[model samples]
Target: MDRKILIYPRGNGEGKGNSMSMFLCLDETTLPPDTKLFVKFLLRVISQTPTKSDDFEFKVENHFGPSCLNWGAQKFMSIVKLNDPKKGYLVGDTCIAEANVTLIGEVTTAS
Candidate 1:
C-alpha cells in the first residue's frame, strides 16, 4: 500500500497555545478489487522539553483506503505555548510525532 504523511498547524484559545496535527493518508487504489483492508497504529508525540512529552498514546483501526487518519479532538495535545515564552514551547519550537501502523488482515467481500 502507498502511504502519505501530512502535518498541519492548529491554534487554540486565541493564542493560549498551538498544536500540530499529524495524519496518515493511505492510497486505496493499491488494494485489490473487492478487498477490504484494516489497519491499526499507536501514535506518540515529543516536544523540546524532556518531560513535556505528550501525555497520551493513540490506537486506532479502520478500513484502509484513500482516507486521512489522525487523532481526534480529545486526543490532540498542545505542542507550543504561543501565549507564554518561558514555558519553552516557543514559536519556533519543534515537536516530533510518530505513528506505528499494523495491518491486521484483508478480506474480500462477495457482491
Candidate 2:
C-alpha cells in the first residue's frame, strides 16, 4: 500500500493561521472498490536539538477507505511553539517531519 503525509504549514480549515495541520492519506486510487485498510500511524515533527526530547508527535489508529481516504489533526501544533527557536522544530529554514505506518488489517466487502 502507498501512503502520503500532508502538511499544512499555515494550517488548514479551522487551524489556519493559528496552528500546523497534518494528515495521513491513503492512495485510494490504488485500492480496489469497497476495500478498507486498518492502520496505526505516528506523525512527528522532529527536533533538531541533541536531546530530541522536544519533538512534537501524534499517533492515530483508523480505517482508511475510498469514503475516508485521510485522517489527522487539524490543530497539530501551535505555530508559536513550532516557530520558537528553543523548540528546535525548524532549523536553518528547514523543517523535518516523519511518519511511521503499520498496516493492521484489510477488509473487503462482498457486493
TM-score of each: 0.58, 0.94
Model 2: pairs clashing at backbone N, Cα or C within 3 Å: none
> Could you tell me which residue pairs clash in candidate 1?
none
Could you say which candidate leads in lDDT? 2
lDDT string for model 2 (1-111, tens) is 888889998899999999999999888779888899999999999999889898899998999998999999999999998899988998878889989999999999957
| Cα shift from native, residue 27, model 2 (Å) | 1.3
- Provide the lowest-lDDT 10-residue window in model 1: 66-75
Candidate 1 lDDT by residue in tens digits, 3-97: 66555546333322455455566666676666767787666554345566433454677766324332333324555432244543443655455
CA displacement after TM-score superposition, residue 89 of candidate 1 (Å): 7.3
**lDDT per model vs. reference:** 0.54, 0.91
